[model samples]
Target: MITMPSIGDNLARLRRRAGFTQENLAERSTVSVSVIRKLERGDRDSASLPTLRKLATALDVTTVALFHPVPRFAPGNTDDRDDLYVMRRVLQPARALSGGGVVTLADDEDAPSSTDVWQSVREINGMFRDSDYAAGVAALPTAITYARAATSAAPEPHQATAWEQLAQTYQTAAMILIQLRKDDLAYYALGLAIDAAHQAGSDMLVASAVCSENWLLTRQARFNEAERAALATAEAIEPSLTRSPQSDIATWGWLNLGAAAAATRNNRMDVAMDSLRRARAAAHVAVGYRSPHVTHWTTFSPAVVAMREVELAMVTGDAGRALKAARSVPSSARPAITYQRFRLDVAAAHIERRHHDEALDVLLQLRATAAGWLRYQRYAHTLTSRLLRSRARAIPLELRDLADFLDVSD
Candidate 1:
């Protein structure tokens, strides 16, 4: 028969691997030192689920890792095994390129031309839109390699296209890395993207890079810097904004949206609202024009504005307002990530209102639609834990299974 390691033993091993002493772990996880010591010594039979969650968050590992050994080549013991595999695969080409060797593609006839690189970039964007994150991850390594090769081998006039494609590929990688909570890696990727954009002499691409950087900063909880960077980038891009070019207007609008998100997180309600208004105005200017220079994965439309309002309301602790704003979101307009986030926010609002069944339903839908994506999100875990705690005796089998899959302690 197969056997499992005791929780204490597993916790101790993971703690050691993370380079934390008992006291260090206690301080970081906010569990008492005595409790940590007793748990490690196997003096305690079990820990509370919330306690386990704190330990997992503190160690930057999954709660499941506290119960089992982490797989090799994983992304720091995250719950999504497929995501880890995909990330490793996606990183291979970048790693190979870093080793001072030229990467060769399957079609060895000639190196990928600028057009080929652009087409690959578009494919990656399509994968993102389709919510096929794994496929996108699987495809990115080859695309990135081709982009890099094109930048070096293409004619001078065509080099800019190749560099722009390379920058876009890196930006996509950064987006995926941030979603995986690998902020440090995301920062590095964004830096590479910005450098490539500068080399391509594309001011618009540079602004896009800054917008991404602002996103990273916000995710890291550096709200002040995020707000400043986003607003400054928007202002810098303002000079190029014309009423006819929708891409410029959309890009400007998106930057302001970033600023508004940051401001909301920073508790600057007035600033946040003002930025949102500016974003809406810019979006209005782009209502009729069409351009190919837009950020393919994210567009600042009325639907996006409504979604931002929901987020802002949530941040400001106005659950009623948040729910009301959510109703304005055009279902067809949101990308996969945006739609998932909308569901999460709605679930949070429902929980706040004690509409437990509705909250659970939304969460279940999210899980069914994107199990791997849900696994990595703390908000999803928190909501599930809350529901389980509130209705422990009458919990449904489906929820129980979800809790087990999420590795919540009983």
Candidate 2:
């Protein structure tokens, strides 16, 4: 018979696999030694989400990985054929670019026109917003080639627009690549994006590129550099505030959001809060108007600022404050991805507070609303496993089915 391991069992196994003694893990995670000992010994039945997050960070693993045996198909597992195939495809253009080869459009009877390229870029941006990664990946290569061609072929007046389109396309590709954990490829794509933005000669576009660079840095765990990049970008564009206050405010607010996120990651709570305050001030000036420029997906509005505030609070280990801020975001103001993140934040806060049922409810809502999106997020698996382990009663059928779908065993 197959045996189901408890969370403690899984934790102990992962700790051993990481070659960390209890004392070492305790020191690294900043959890007390006694708590770590109790957890590994199964004497403690549950842990706060923040504590688990710290331990997972120290272990260089996702929190979900600490809850159960790593799946055969896990992303980093060499044996995962699907992962291997996706990684190969995602890295193809980056590898070619690194080797000093440009990706060319396949020979055809007619090349895509500038209008066609612009329309395609917009469609791909929509696909990204909808979280349709596969579709975006399928469309990207041709779009990239067409956008690059248009940039070179368009009239002087139209050249900047074409370059902006090309930059947006590359930025979209970088976004998808990062989500796939193909950070090297993502970095290459972002560099291309920045170059195109500079060629476009738009301060807004450059600021957008800087914002994306900050995001890449944050994902790579270079939090200090991410903070610096964001702050510099915001400052560089501050002079434009008088000429185009709304556009400048949007860009500035978005950069502050990035700065806040980086600060939060570095455990600089004061810095993070200060950044958020600046973002909030900018948002007030913009008054919820969306910038006409395609800001590389940076939306600056009151709601968006609040969303970042909630996220910062979560990162700072203030679950109550996070939940409170999340609740204040109006539904009309919440974009699809932002709403999804808000729900996840709510669930995370609940988990930290030991409100398992409430946490599960929020997760179930997310699953129902965006099952495909939720499936790929490691935190979803972590939250599900926590719920399963924390409750002594038989698992709810809905929760169990969700866990099974995510391939989370015990």
Candidate 3:
């Protein structure tokens, strides 16, 4: 079967094969230097199609070539999805696995409702929310089994909640594995989430599944594809999905768009700006009292908004604006995973401004935080090493240590 490397892998490969560093690619492709940094790091998901075309043209390749599948574990081939996904999860030091025992989901072919199957799933989510990575990872197999079984079972209208629950479980598993640097496994699980959502025939379920998949697509840097998926999901569900407090389907769609826009290339600033405006409008519409889920998404404080703005500013080469936005991100509000990502963006912005000291400071923090998670992410280490070596400045000592640990050198 033909497969595509996630956007990050494809861009990195094309850039190197064309004998271009991130800086070189940034200069040629009209994509911001920070975007090049994130794309190569595998932390970003989307890029503007126009920018992609530029990069493709520069490499003397078609746009489709950017989506070419990366072979699994070929010698000198460091694009393995699994390693990358694992590294993403553990990159934050304070998020070490803590509690929650493994709970298995048994498949009963005769069962009519998926509710029983979802009990284990809820437990897993709780464990994850509590930062219990070990617990979440251990329970993943059971959740997958139950979800598959639920999908195969006969559907009952009353069992919609069960199916939704199952879909969410699969999504949760995907999220965990992605953070763990297991992208292939995460993709497989996300596929299951999509299947469960489809089978459930619930718009809310579908939206939730798409929300999760959107991030996965972004990591590959497939911005246009990811936005399409989000928009399609929203449009499909809007008419059927109620506008009540129970679920703010519209708001979710807008958030997805905002994120997608932030990932888009520097050349598409207008498109990105439009998407953010819509996102802000959607959030405004969601101000009234609502369900826990709706409130969680809609009322999610300005912190996430600020983060997106920082991303937008970085992509636009507005260092002052990006720094201003970055400063608005609440230190404690972000989880370790997201905080590390924010720092990387800040570092890139500093690099753009030629503030080497600031950039090195951010890089050091990343190194300190990311070292604990190194065992989980070979791909990130490889990319970071390459960036470090290619840059004119001396590599930070901490990152040097991390490179040695991963056995990856630029």
Candidate 4:
């Protein structure tokens, strides 16, 4: 689904169009001739955003212009591609009614209680956090439908809670779809989530939904948009450290963390680091909160702050720092698929350190523990591919097995 060409492709096309030889471009950008050559020849996965900015400045283009985001999907067979049909039906149903009316298959059925609807929403969240994506996906439509019915049928005071529940369900559905790379459907679900959140008249809820929006944008390589939206939301919801509730601080901190992620990917090192610092400050307050709060069960845990530090360091190709930061996140009791993604950073750090056996060990452990979720992670596949390519001889059976599971091919 990622249509972007390889960065090398974009670079070659742009350089030729601009009538600049590699040497000429290097002279203009102050990048080494060798680095430019390696990049154009596709020998490197990526350059730091600042390096890319220099290249873009010389080419008279935005920094993003140099980025051909790496493709994130494993090869999909026919069955795999259509696996989201049920979700699509729910999210993008071709309803016959366009009258701004509630259309339903069970109009005569009584609306569920606000309590029931909220419970259903919580169950779906629980399922997703447990990595029971099948249960989560199966539960989503029912939860969304019941929530919608409640919004119309519940008492006026209860209707707001219904709307909020609906918003949360929609957002959760979007999160699931995003993991599956059903981005179009995720977008549809997120649009409805935003609407329901706004209708709930809770600015905090809306902010929470926007956190998901920021994540989606970040994944799609829309770094500038993600950064702008997240920073703005964080600013709007900037809680008073002394008086704000723990949830408020967590939400505000989560926004900064989101901003940090976007900024990191865009290669704005200073901006990303600053946002991480702010998020860490908030994490100090949220430490007492044991229950997951806000979007994707995100908390301002020191682990999360450390996770971002590791991510930023990895993106900037600082394996040593990444490995150091990785130590801050405990290896035990890392709950939620969202937080579990940090292990990939750990594996990548091991790779960078040329600890191939250690890297493989980490990946194998991750899959052994979270097999279902690992199948959906394109980064895992990408990392596996790297290890596979780097193996000069004797590809281990486990490595081969992992590659097959990831649908990775030579």
Candidate 5:
């Protein structure tokens, strides 16, 4: 029998899992915050049908779904799976990344070997390294499927490793999806990643997953939540770092926190800079000491530290420092780390120095390198459009080429 207490507990669980506060739900559902609070706390036994409907709508579920454990094989189940599979296929084409391209529903998941799982993880990592965002996004469900199968197939201790790998894989997928403007998918992937990390008892993996979620929150413009998530990740890893001096993982948390702070409009530039300085120092320690785990997963070389510092400098309006740091990163090598976004920064810096020719040169190089469909392409186009919009003098021919690419005429 489903008692009122059981019902209330379920409601509270689902509400929290959906990343909502009582006030947030109340605002969306047109129910008083206190009434919703009372329902969750078992202080209210009954709600009107209309109030329930509002709650269901705000939660993006049917009222019946709210009351019951959703069956994995229900009609809605297949509906969600089909939607997920199609989305996976569309956003993640096979050739977009290095490894196995797509996961057919008919693929045999029951027969994967340990080697197969390891190779797949490597491929996923390569996809991220290559900035194959779409392919990385597509491979998420496949990873989760393999992860679930691995648990049932592997014996006790091995199951833990399987969970950890899946958590990392899902975290990567979540980050890629966030960049692609797929917020709902990003949220779900990160949630799954967090659960798997906890199940595996991997504090490091847990912090990594939290970092990804913090990024998703930042993108959603939820500055407060982003800061909290980043800070929590840093705090989780700080204790471990003290004993082991594992700088790479520790620096990652700090870097993420600094990114969140820098992104907020109200963020103090000095504080952000200080955080970044600490991150850079930690990254140097990680790179120098060469811990095996850090080398395998969290290695931060001098180049990465320099690039991140440059990015922070640009955000903080230190153009000369940004320019010097930008030159420190070889163009061919840095693309994998920063993606095409760096080109826009270089161009912006050039414009700041009244070097439109140099700026146009960087923008043209970007056009040649980045595939036209990527979001960065649109960003470059817009920036170039703005630069060319109002000029005191006649537009240079090189600048005109950029205007043509953006499909905007002066």
Candidate 6:
């Protein structure tokens, strides 16, 4: 959300790189020196498109270069290496043919039937939905191998189904990696998912993979890129609101929500709100719809839109609005995964208001009910760490337990 190395930071860095002072850049671009000074001092959060274009021309760089900042993260430990090695090898096999070509798929039923493959994939999808990450990740490799085999070995009539499931399996793997903060690997997995989706010749399947890509980019703080990608995909698949199937409408609405989240992070509230309005129309028709494709998100619904509004409010640090929107998130029949995230947003709102005990209570409940999901959330870790800082001594036992579970050090 206007993350580090912001527009101001970029302008200052680019100005220096171009060997121009504030006055020099102003004179070169025919923009005022005061505006330039205000921008570099972080007084201005953004520039008009025309102003940015002029500055880009003067700096001999593209307008978008000003908005690009690689998302930063803390260093991962050695355990990540070991935990991910098998997954890495499965997605990217050894390149050298001369190497002792190891055997693969040694089981008796290497080429699983299409029915068997779909059943396994559905189970894996359930694991993902249940936040059973340990079982999900453990089951992924075998599922992927079987899905790959089924693509060629399954009955000819069902080959398309095989490819579709393959895409689903890969997208699931990508989602898991995204949770692990392994964005690079997630990118590769989504690439494979897209390829498989295209091979299946299912536009809906491809839309699912594209949605996953948007999710990954959003987490990485590539806000504009995510919004652009999601909006583009939505445009391509913009369904006939009156005629398209519920799946079509749901997919379209989900993309709009992704765009909304990304745009809000960039402080484009108008753009974000416009996206929400677009999604709302679709959600009305496809309320409480479930996915036929394995990709998560129980079809875009009013409940989800309300949940996301709370999240978007948090992005802008408008805790008052966040808590207000939280009231609209449905108490009954709420999508289980989405409600959990809304709970986090509620906790974040409390944190913003310095309601530390309330925040801890929310997190403690999540830890009790969704420990697997809670374990992988960097947001939880950061919130726990922040709470820890506020109490240097006599730590509350519940706070200490949460901090320890999230591996947050004071």
Name the best candidate (by TM-score).
6
1-410: candidate 2 lDDT, tens digit per residue:
21122456777788899999988888998877776776767665434334555778898986545444321233323343343233234335454354212332222223436666766677677766776665555446545656766776688878888888888888888887666566777888888888888998878888887887887898788999999989988888874444666767777888998999999999897888888888888877776566454456455678888887777788779999998888778867644676687778788889998998899888888788777567767778888888889879888898898898777878
What TM-score do all the candidates reach, one by one?
Answer: 0.73, 0.74, 0.58, 0.76, 0.64, 0.77
Give the runs in model 2 whose Cα sits over 4 Å from its true position: 1-111, 239-243, 291-293
| Model number with the top lDDT | 6
In model 6, the Cα lDDT at residue 255 comes to: 91
When summed lDDT is taken over every stretch of 10 residues in candidate 2, the lowest stretch is 100-109
TM-score of 3: 0.58
Clashes of each: 0, 0, 15, 0, 0, 0
List clashing residue pairs in candidate 2.
Answer: none
- Candidate 1 weakest ten by summed lDDT: 100-109
Off by over 4 Å in 5: 1-110, 137-140, 239-264, 288-297, 332-335, 372-374, 390-410
Cα misplacement distance, residue 5 of candidate 5 (Å)? 46
Q: Could you give candidate 4's per-residue lDDT for residues 102-144 as a string of tens digits?
A: 2222222334666556566766676666665655554454456
Sequence-dependent TM-score of model 2: 0.74
lDDT of each: 0.71, 0.71, 0.57, 0.74, 0.59, 0.77
Output the better candidate (3/6) by lDDT. Answer: 6
List where candidate 3 sits over 4 angstroms from the true fold: 1-119, 126-137, 147-158, 177-185, 237-243, 246-255, 284-299, 334-337, 363-399, 405-410
Tell me the tens digit of each residue's lDDT in model 6 across 201-246.
9888788888889888998899999999899989998999889988
Model 5, residue 375: displacement in angstroms?
3.8
